[model samples]
Target: MMLSSMTLSRKYVILGIAVAGLIGSLTSAGAQIQYQTGQNVAPVYEGWMHNDDGSIDMVFGYLNRNWEEVLSVPIGPENNVQPGGPDRGQPTIFVPRRFTQPPGERREQCVFRVRVPAGWGPKQEIAWTLTAHGRTDKAVGTLDPLDEIDTHVIAENRAFTITEGNKPPSIQSLKADPDTVTLPGTVTLTARVTDDGLPKPPAPQPGSGNAGGRGNAAAASSAVAALAFMGDASLDCR
Candidate 1:
């Protein structure tokens, strides 16, 4: 009986050590540099209607690994639709602005907001998705993971499709009238930039549909505005 009790004691000691080690490993894993989605703008279709009589207000949100709210910011607003229309109700919140995790910090949640136009169709919402990019130092995760969380918002019957990936701004149009440059006088240069505007695009595969998708429309317009400025400058030089 004495020998059996001694063996039992020894076994319990070994078990305790194993359990403690396992717990330590789990703790370390939990701390292993996880990331939360940062808030950002969702893509908008060209010529699509928006709130505030075609204008939009975008807000963003951020979270930590334990699924806790971290930070939020307003990324700015865009007047995607024309100004004259019946009040499309109050502006909807789309793509709540948020912050990315700083190095060495864990993230919990990322939220986004967009103002939806009243009476917008379901298809319009279907094509829309909230695409967010992790900071350069962080890796992108799968859509399945993101869908599990309440990360996106659609107001007034507007829906959205969420995706993830990396993206850089693309120059949609660039022109220098009189393509050649001469040494003597200044030549106006026109540049148009189109970007998904995300640090990255979701599912960045080859021939992806609308590399920038609906977001490209807004970017294209901005590029055009920039090009117009260049045109003015070029004529001024002449």
Candidate 2:
């Protein structure tokens, strides 16, 4: 009886130690799996930028706090415009992050409107929300009437016709539709106009930098994509 009691005590001690060790291992494994989460910052509206066509652009910037790619930062469905519903306004934007910008730093001018509709008046506001990684950010901008002066005036006033960044825009695919119209009437014209100063779009051009334009809504996305290509240094901006 004494020997049996002693054996039972030894078995209990061994089982307790094994159970403790397993708990410790699990705790250590959990520590290894856990990590820090990053913040997805909202875009900053840079205000209305003027275009030569008597229209203005809504310039914006953003920051992705994570070091990795924050894919598909989309505008939320609840986001909308007043008096005309969402369709009367711009569509939701898709802003993704790449290595072009340093992690956690604001990517300035990441996106911009080629042109905002005219007659928006001096103080119109649009609220937009972008969501990514289960995080949401909202930004609002006043479509302030463009307070702009002629660039030619500034350059000419100083007798500086050409500056370091001065670039002459190209008129690509310029055409007058209905080559044979009714005698001396108006014919529909179509063309792509791009400014050569900024980053080129992802699409390759024969031999050029970025292209810029504020065309019909149908062509807006394509134009924006081409403009993005200009940022590629491999394309040789020229």
Top TM-score: which candidate number?
Answer: 2
* lDDT tens digits by residue: candidate 2, 53-153: 76766655554454444344322354433334443333343334443334443353425442467766666665556566667676767765443324454
Overall local distance difference test of candidate 1? 0.36
Write the residue-wise lDDT of candidate 1 on 1-238 in tens digits: 9999999999999999999999999999977743443433333322222355754333223222223322222222221222221122212233222232234433222222345445543333222222233321111122222222222332211222344552434754367766787766666566555667543335433444665643322221222222111112322211
lDDT of each: 0.36, 0.50
TM-score of 2: 0.40
C-alpha TM-score for every candidate: 0.24, 0.40
Q: How far off is model 1, as Cα RMSD?
A: 21.1
